[model samples]
Target: MQETILNIYLVIDKGSVTSFRAKAYEMEGEDSAKIGFLKERATEDFASAFVFDSPKNKKGEYMPYKKFSKLEKQGLQYQLFEEIFEKFRVPQNPLICVTPVVDGEVFGKK
Candidate 1:
């Protein structure tokens, strides 16, 4: 048997910058129905952008902007995500990403 780790990446726009992380975590979970709901709730605390984990088949592959018709290569969404990360203390520029890297685990049925 193997256990899978699931994580969601979200951008927090804290007005003060110091309290955003706390606010972001407070709203993330499996129970979340609407991504916008979390963002709206946290608007007072900070603005947030949540990136749900891509399907396994899509792993390691490039993800493009949802609004853009072009494929990942031409998509600027990834770069935009990085731009948001840089706003925090993260050192990486648009080229580097701060999203959580997750590994999956499956168990055989007995």
Candidate 2:
């Protein structure tokens, strides 16, 4: 069976410098349930945005945020989760980003 890669990204709005495309955070090979949880968190935090995608498709198609957001209002929620930190750090700003070429070096290493 093919592994599911749940890709999480940060979408800068039209006014921001990085508004052209979504900035990738990390790819997650999690089950649908965990993916759902990640989506839920993103929806609540980023509002109606499809920053999370399945790169397996490779189409780079934008997922309908409204559809997910509408269904979630019916009480979809997660209680607890495990924390795994691999690429989270304060480089130039407090915001957590993983853009290597645009955001500069990872962990500020030369």
Candidate 3:
């Protein structure tokens, strides 16, 4: 059996006004590629707050909440990505990265 790979790109504008653009592609390969991309306007007011909300260990290290034989990280990434997308009303597509640059600074991606 062969595997299919998907790539996504997201262009976000969080300066003065908020906007988003998305692109996707599909390919055949054994390994998958990055799922998301971020592009922000040249302004300090815009910040990226979307991140994989994973569990942390006692030592302040990030860890997966569950175990999986394959695509665990990818799954988690998608899950978190979806959460942000839904919150911001981003479009959905396979093999694409949806980058969102929002207003304000809220630092924390785990």
Candidate 4:
């Protein structure tokens, strides 16, 4: 059995800054149905782009964004996206930050 654990972060900057985390899991393809349901929910919730943390290789190097498509490919991103979409009711063009780095320390930081 294999499982992927991700530390998902969502950073939003208005006047101040905010960050959130959501955990997502898929058990060796056995739970794919749940993943699909989440994907559908996300699509119905938003019609804009989703900003994700750059995928990293085994060496911890960032990979290009084009290399990945579906959010489910990165379980954290998928779960975070769905959770935010359902809870926040963010606008269609909302930015879903998926990086471990916090705001104020990065571009969106104060």
Task: Give me the candidate number with maximum TM-score.
Answer: 3
lDDT for 104 (candidate 2)? 22
- Where does candidate 4 stray beyond 4 Å? 5-9, 15-17, 30-110
Ranking by lDDT: 4, 3, 1, 2
Indicate whether candidate 2 or candidate 3 has the larger lDDT: 3
> What is the Å distance of residue 81 in model 2 from its true position?
22
The segments of candidate 1 whose C-alpha lies over 4 angstroms from its true place after superposition are: 1-26, 34-76, 89-110
lDDT of 2 by residue, 26-93 (tens): 33444555455444444233323233322112554432334334544753311000011222321221
User: Tens digit of lDDT per residue, candidate 1, span 1-110?
Assistant: 11111122322222111111212222223433333443334433322333333321245533332322243347543543343353333334212212321221111111
Predicted candidate 4, C-alpha RMSD = 14.1
lDDT of 3 at 74: 58
Best by lDDT: 4
Clashing pairs in 4: 104-109
Each candidate's lDDT (Cα)? Answer: 0.29, 0.28, 0.33, 0.39
Native-to-model Cα distance after best TM-score fit, residue 48 in candidate 1, in Å: 11
Q: Model 3: which residue pairs collide?
A: 7-95, 7-96, 8-96, 8-97, 9-97, 10-99
lDDT of 4 at 81: 54
Write down the RMSD of all candidates, one decimal each. Answer: 16.1, 15.1, 12.1, 14.1
* Candidate 2: C-alpha lDDT: 0.28
Q: Where's the lowest-lDDT run of ten residues in candidate 2?
A: 77-86
TM-score of model number 4: 0.24
Writing each residue's lDDT as its tens digit, candidate 4 over 28-107 gives 44435444444444322222333444334797754333333344475434543555455445445433333432333332
Residues 1-110 of candidate 3 have per-residue lDDT tens digits of 32222222222223321222222223344333232211222222123323323334697654322331133355644653454455445446434333333343322122
